[model samples]
Target: MRAIWKGAVSFGLVNVPVRLFSATENHDVQFRQVHEKDGGRIRYQRVCSIDGEEVPYSDIAKGYETSDGRMVILTDEDMKSLPSRSSKEISIEKFVPSEQIDPLLFDKSYYLEPEKSSVKPYVLLRDALEKADRMALVTVAIRTRMTLAVLRVREGVIVLQTLLWADEVRQPDFGVLDEDTHATKKELAMASSLVDSLAGDYEPDEFEDDYSEAVEALVESKIEGGEVKAPEAAPEEETEVVDLLAALQRSVDAAKAAKRGGGTKDEAEATPEKKKPAKKATKAKKKAS
Candidate 1:
């Protein structure tokens, strides 16, 4: 696998040049949206809400919506004006007991590979961490953003796992939980016995994604049985003659009228192009069933 980042792990006066690689990947099966009747792929356009005109990707800008419903659009230059960190050093802040780090705070994990010349120092750090049973708190700038992370040993490699900010984790609050509940001595004993009866050592290999496996098998069988649909050719777009802003306003009005049960069949079908996707989706559901 290609290294996603190249940097140095810095602690005190020691600096070990290393490469970062993502430690995990997903293997989930994916499906594409298509028109059920013709098997054509469903395409979505980026239409402007105010103008009802399809906007090209190049014209798009990031917008931040305020709590008061005001939008703040930021251009590429505006974003660049914001503070960013692109440092190539993973700075070790301090060493803390492994137990102090909550598993819930852990996010994406990456494997660190040392350069040939820095192998000795890398091994020293890894061995030292393993012997102390401590995790190194670190600060690293990945993708131009600074984040807190921990360096821990897994197998023979040093793994870097990013952490969520303290405020990111929400506190649990439930009215039902506020009420006092108690279990009797006999009930507690029965629960403990039940837990003991099902207790076993965890072996990840013993488990499997049964649903995903079944889906794969079903799809393979259908393919073998010649149950695939041929995709239809998409139609070319013609020049838009309607006024974009007027069309957008009309679309909004039509939607509101439909929601209020005041729309006729003709009014519902006024914009055939906009309605085609919904019509196809309904057909797809029927076909799937």
Candidate 2:
């Protein structure tokens, strides 16, 4: 993976040169809108309402609307005049107990790799943090905005996880939770028993996306069953809803299966993409189907 940003981590009188790289990526399936009849992809264009004409990309400018409904267009030069922080350093403020930082504050995580010359200092800081069981609170500018982050050692590497400000976290104040709530002692005991019975080590690799797997299986079944090859056949719709008890039982079974070393290959799986083939190819594919 390529480094997204290059900077130095500053603490005390030491500055360790490091490269920042995103540590996570999304693997969710995505879909595009298309015409069902012809299988043509749909696209959107930027059109102005005033003249009902398509606007060129270069003609667009940022506009701030005032309370009085007047739009003030801001140009590139005007945006440059606005105050923004851009720094080439990740300045450490202080080290605090790792447990004090809530998981919700974390936004994104990045790995910090030290430069050849700065390896010694980087190891020094990592060792200090590990020994103290703490995380370093830091600030760094990224792209067009400043971010609050925490530096912590993970798997022999320093990981910088960006955080959200306090104001960004909404106060959970739904009235249903505020009133006096009570659970029967029997119910509580059963819940605790349930929790204890299911508790186990969190091996992230054990879990799989069953929905995506089912989707692929369904598609493969259709292809082999000649549903697509013979479009004249009625389309089959399969849907099932598992009850609460059934779901709980399946979870337990899955845990047991995991204990038996059950797992699929770790490969990026995405929803199948529907593309508009060339005219002749599309015709041939449809005719063959």
Candidate 3:
């Protein structure tokens, strides 16, 4: 991948020259807006709203409308006047425990590779961060905008993860959480037991995006068959909801069964659904009596 930015990480007297590359990539299939009949790509042109005239790119200028309906035009020089510290350097502010930083503040991650001459200093800083178990708080300017970022050790390399500003994180003032909704001890205990039964280390590889895979498979089948086919019908089941205690017991049993090479933990819980229709039969017998 091409490097997005080149800069030096400065801490104390050490300067680590490095190039930044984005850590994540999008794998989504892209589509375009097109004419439905001819499959021609749709296009848009810039035009002046007031004069109703086609405007050239050179005529465009950034403008903000005031509350009084006045247009305030800003030029390139106005933007250049803004302070940008991360243009060519990443200055470390302070080191804090990795846990101290909230995960929500993280925006984007980039991989940092040291220049040939700065390898020693880079290794020194990387090792120090690894050993101290701390992440360096830093501010960087990308694309003329100042951004909060963290300098951390990832595997054997240093990673720069951009963070959101304090003002960017909105405070939760919604009254829903303030309302009192209590759970009984028995219910909480049963829920905890249910959770324990299903508890296991999170391995991301164990999960798959089934929906995406199904869509891709459908597309492939359509390509091979040269026509669309009706989807296979799924079993129709009633939404049977059992009582609290009964549901908990059934769930616990199902979890045990699943751990013992049976199907998912929901199997035993579903057996209670058979009782729903039986209740209707009892009501019919009562009416006949």
Candidate 4:
């Protein structure tokens, strides 16, 4: 909820004062390394390899190794001399269609709230971007580092999302895909049909961290003085070599059944009944009387 950064969004002569807050948070349980036998906390030390001695923070200096095995030490002042692009302001370089940017480039998102006096300009920019269906490509400096980011309108609010540079993305090597592949017209058609049958509107709430939930359950069981029972591993069913067309057809049929409210056997069995026992009803009536 706390604002991570406070700055202004600048484009040409217009500047909107805003506070930036992170849109996401880390929810994973954290663990620390410890000695198993003594249950002692493990500690790390910065040591020099050549001298085999722990170095103090004051003694540590940044260095770069050269081809001749010589290390050139860089002082704090030397590092400060490096040209910084992201310091004072968030600069918007260009605006591009939101659809044109690849989803993979998006890293993290932050909510932007404008100052009271700056609301007009903020809404102006937000509405402009919304009308154009475009996002502003921006560069901002945070903690001495420059970041490539996108400024877009989300639900009447401006949002900034940090992006990864083009060089950071690894090229998808299609060598494996090109090896040996052949599909019949009927097979491809059936596969496409199966995909269409399974397609649904994206709902992030429907997904969950099942593995984390299981792990938490295991931890709770252990903490409650109950023996953690090893789950009986289900036997892996052997995969049948079916005709591609037939397999896709089966998948399509299953998807269609799911979409049509036809509950699976497990779902039907798991559903709780609404009927109450006569004895329980009598007991409740007696208690009320």
**Weakest ten-residue segment in model 3 by summed lDDT:** 233-242
Q: Which stretches of candidate 4 lie over 4 Å from their true place?
A: 65-70, 178-182, 226-289
Clashing pairs in 1: none
Candidate that beats the other on TM-score, 2 or 3, i.e. the better one? 2
Q: Model 2: runs farther than 4 Å from truth?
A: 65-70, 217-289
Note the residue pairs that clash in candidate 2. Answer: none
User: Each prediction's TM-score against the native?
Assistant: 0.80, 0.72, 0.71, 0.71
106-175: candidate 4 lDDT, tens digit per residue: 9999999999999999888999999989999999987778989999988888889999999999999878
How much is 195 displaced in model 3, in angstroms? 2.1
lDDT of 2 by residue, 1-289 (tens): 9999999999899999999999999866666676576545566778998999988666989999999999999999999998777789999999999999999999999999999999999999999999999999999999957889999999999999999999999988899988899999999999999999999999999999887788888988988987553224434333233355676786676666555655521211211242234456779988898
- Tens digit of per-residue lDDT, candidate 1, span 119-223: 999999999999999999999999999999999999999999999999999999998988899999999999999999999999999999998999999999999
Best by TM-score: 1
Model 1, C-alpha of 174: deviation from truth (Å): 1.2
Q: Listing every candidate in turn, what is its Cα RMSD in Å to the true structure after a full C-alpha superposition? A: 16.0, 23.1, 29.7, 29.4
Relative to the true structure, candidate 4 reaches a TM of 0.71
Stretch of 10 with least lDDT, candidate 1: 237-246
lDDT of 3: 0.85
How far is 14's C-alpha from truth in model 3 (Å)? 0.9
Report model 2's TM-score to 2 decimal places: 0.72
